[model samples]
Target: MSVRSSAGRVRCPVCARPQAQCLCSLIPRLWPPTQLLVIQHPDEASHALNTARLLVPGLVNAHLLITESLQEHPAWMRRLQDPRWRNELLFPGEQAQVLLPAAVDLRPRRLVLLDGTWRKARKLVYLNPVLQSMAQVCLPAGLVSRYRLRKVPQAGALSTIEAGAEALSVLHPGFDKHALLAPFEALIEGQIRAMGLARYQQNYGAASDPAVE
Candidate 1:
């Protein structure tokens, strides 16, 4: 069911965003070579700026499962166990390998991403032991997340979609990162409009603004 805005406008059923800022048209179904599986925390589903929900649908090979623990889903566990594709965890750590072609040798890889705040994402890893067993990969240092609506708690932090896009860009230069981020940028712009330029500038403008002394 689609939600209604305070102004009584029917929101887009697919994206759940307001009619004015609906991402239905901007979203693309690019079944990239690398498979993407996003495990989301239930808490994020209610967030208006949730990017995982928007990202999964755009990719034909991507799947989004909302759960704190992967052990609860036997079928998904079996899929992860499948030897057809090497499953790797996308997270940062001291032992994490940098995501690169020479490093990540698997031809057809399955990248598992966890979507949540720093604290909650850590808890997800703790709850799922299989995630711990998999080879962990991290994007190169010095990359920044485009998610300006929320404060970044750590260096090189990226939203679920941004992480996926970055990984894809590294794996396949042909992958259209811009196509993937179109809806994401639109969503942010729409929110800024809703808040008005003055209010957005007062709260987050400085952080998002690139010009500085």
Candidate 2:
């Protein structure tokens, strides 16, 4: 499968999206108090529609680490053991509790988000014992995911960018969650324009109207 355009379309080095669809200019300069860490599966690093890239430029506190296994990475291990930050995995499962502002302690937190398709995310969790041991939390109930470019695995499942924004909103109460998604929505619209309305609608089953935004 082609991860990017092979037909010589110049690409943006920052966002890695095609130059025509690049949202680099839309990335806002905002740093939230809580640290954001994204552990992305290797396969997703080069995917055309990966949302993890969007997080890097949008949030100054965000960092993306790509790996299939975190069993022996020095830096990863160091961060996991860091005493200054409490790490919690942003995942939903039987053990995951609903993430609320009051549930978080006053101490600084490093939110670890797994970035990949549902199957890949589950594989990453299973492969990394450290991740499995971290405290797990889920986003608030009824928060609909607007990541229309791809099919969600289940109801309430959010894209990496959306999840990060929601977590930041909870962690930093005054932050605007909707602003974080502006670039994401723009990216989706750009893709729809690139693909043409008919094809876009056929693929995603949604009307392609730039004005709808």
Can you write out model 1's per-residue Cα lDDT over 35-99, one digit (the tens) per residue? 89999988877677889878888899999899997878999898787777689899896679988
Each model's TM-score, in the order given?
A: 0.89, 0.89
Best by lDDT: 1
Per-residue lDDT of candidate 2, residues 152-206 (tens digit):
7788889999999988898778998777778888887777677778876788788
What root-mean-square deviation over C-alphas does model 1 reach? 3.1
Estimate the Cα RMSD of every predicted model relative to the unseen true structure: 3.1, 3.2
Worst 10 residues of 2 by lDDT: 1-10
Location of the lowest summed lDDT over 10 successive residues in candidate 1: 204-213
Off by over 4 Å in 2: 1-8, 102-104, 207-213
As a whole number from 0 to 100, the lDDT of residue 148 in candidate 1 is 68
